[model samples]
Target: MVTAKVETAGPLILVVGDVMIDRYIFGDTTRISPEAPVPVVRAGAEEIRAGGAANVAANVAALGVACRLLTICGDDGAAVELNGLMARQGVTLDCVTDKGQRTTEKIRLISGVQQIARIDHDCTVTDAARATLAARFEALLDGVGAVIFSDYAKGVLTALPELLAIAAQRGVATFVDPKPVDPARYRGAFLLKPNMAEFQALFGSCPPDRIVDRARSALDEMGLDHMLITRGAKGILLVSRDGEVVDRPTQALEVFDVTGAGDTIIAALVVGLVQGLSMATAIDQANIAASIAVSRRGTYVVTRGDLDERLYRREHFMTKLVPLAMLCDRIARARETGARVVFTNGCFDVLHAGHVRLLAEAKRQGDILIVGLNSDASVRRLKGAPRPVNALADRAEVISGLAAVDHVVVFEDDTPLALIQALRPDVLVKGGDYTPDSIVGADVVRQSGGRVMTVPLLPGRSTTATLGALGR
Candidate 1:
């Protein structure tokens, strides 16, 4: 996995929209209510933190960046509490308020991990109050690297169009975590991120295969340069204006609570972008951050330390065969850390000393080693009807279990040409008596500035020789 690098000056992110005080009342549910058929929650502990756009800013700060929140609040106790929490998290808040308005607050009563009740106190601001908020937002854009529109459909984001226009005029890159209400309000945004449900609301239903084209259609109508649609456990897709689409799968995670996961995604994405990472790399990092977010309960925030630790752990183990998309993500992350990747392919119908030596030596040539195994059908076509004594799954499992193998991918074709072209590893290794120039994908590796290597075969030890001896 890639190591996340922190810049000394750290990018400054400006978040605009609604801010809220999220109040959690933890209690025990021990008895039924006397007056009604309901479980009684005996209050025990209470805690409050920033929510909505404030949470986005907190996430930005948690990632070791400077964050300023421009929002609307009320001259009330909740607003005061929100401000104090933001201060403690090192997030600057520039809010516009009027005594006549009520600060938005969500009070959730939880009995252990289950929420029993919730109380919402919210209000929208008048046109004059919104104008004041726009002015405050405009004043803070001087040193901002990117602007995030964290719209929660609360009163604070009523003037989204004006704010978007203002950011465009200043040539600032803008990211929006949109509400499902309307698509037109997000016109000219550099990136619009919506979860699957929200995306379905705006663009109707989309087949899994057609998501890219669907996103492109929406981007055209809204004048957005890019759209990132988050698909829960399915990962995210980035569709750009140039008709380029990158689909990144979600990191493997054990989910506990999904609250505030979206906020974490957008925060990491904008920060990575401003740090000069490619959009695909930024989205990969964000997906990793989001995976960490869902593994905990409540509104969890991921820090830079958390990211660094997880990535460091991933570099040390090989668990099982991964999907092609997931393998691509791993390769990209490895590349980010300047690690060389070595790839080899074969139909290992039987394991032998020759295979072992080739894999071990290939691994020695790079930091990562990937083995591409031919599928059952491909093996049948190449090695005849009864060639492969083992199934694809069994062969992949055996290959992945090796200490030298970091990843194993099965290809359906007789040759690994397409897979090699897509992955473009730093070195292509093969175990054979053939010369490097005679290798199947040697030219592909050479054209991409990578080397083609041929490891010497072990004397009298081959899969065919072993199988022939067993036949007797």
Candidate 2:
């Protein structure tokens, strides 16, 4: 449903909550240690990433939205590393440094794909630091379109009620990834995102069928506008104050790790809302983003390009037969992400081994391979009457099913000059018989700084030869 690239010029998103560092020490375990009876890991790599609320902000920025994070941090080395990570992600940091506390950090020892142990250096904010954070929140609320509260119950969100009131007064929408503290503190927020377990912990347990009713009741009781309950493996459920409920199944095919998936959902949801999408549409996009997050290990940031590709695939899932206009739009979006587009046009009246080889080779030349099929009328004009062994629809469908073909567009012209001019693909490909200068539209492609090349045809395979053998 998201047809175009998200406009990044809209509003600023303010993320305020607990921030921490997630450090992973990856190694291979050979045998048990004599002293501790634990596997001795031979260290291979060490990686650090933003965690908690900082992760939420990173995901927001990764979507090309303007974001600023307001959190409390200690004046320690971890704080410095956290700042650097946020800066690299283009997240503006408005952190309150507390000299008396140590910055929170979670160090995980990973053996292969398994986590061996986790060590936590936890820190809580002081009243003085909370006051400072509140002041900073108010100062940054002027241009904020949405506020995200990523609470980890790390003592930073103790003043959530006051912060919610301030954002409410400014008429800015607030979203909360709530901790199981006091539900009343999240009142007046626009939406609250809680996983299945957290939902039961906050509001008393209820059957799956009655979740909507309970969520509606919770929404009314908390003075919230909506609630998103994430059910792992089951899907996401959206309950609004006006008795509208929408449930979307999880999009993940294989979930490698679910770390920071909730953050990805909230971040993408807010971004979608800021882009003027409906609540249901935003939730759908959020579901897609969560699927991408869980496919990777540890915390992951889903970018705009990643979402675009997933949406494109979903749209063309059944078949890659697309109209020229739609294909042009898709090409534009792909080009923005630095993807190379390869194009070749032919009748493809009879699918054969030679055609398959050519398509496969074309895909190897670029990231996306677009096949231009000549319409029946165009084939009649170019190859004479009764030349095509198949209709336009049949040929297009067969070509779209090939693994190397990313998209199939039917062009009416005898030559694909018009499509080539419109699409302006990065690479223009043809069969072996044609030279670079002899290929139709090669000049136009070359004028646009595109490459023109040809692939060698299979010696003994051809549609003409097959038709002759069939005595058609």
Highest lDDT, which number? 2
Q: In lDDT terms, how accurate is model 1?
A: 0.84
Per-residue CA lDDT of model 1 for 46-80, tens digit only, reads 88877888888998898878889888888889988
Give each model a TM-score: 0.66, 0.74
Colliding residue pairs in candidate 1: none
The reply for model 1, stretches above 4 Å from the true place, is 1-10, 318-472
Count of clashes in candidate 1: 0
Instruction: Write one digit per residue (lDDT tens) for candidate 2, span 78-112.
Output: 99999999999999999999987988999999998
Off by over 4 Å in 2: 1-10, 24-42, 45-47, 107-119, 317-472
Please report how far candidate 2 places residue 377 from its true position, in Å: 9.1
Q: What is the lDDT of residue 373 in candidate 2?
A: 88
Total backbone collisions for each predicted model: 0, 0
* CA lDDT, every model vs. true structure: 0.84, 0.89
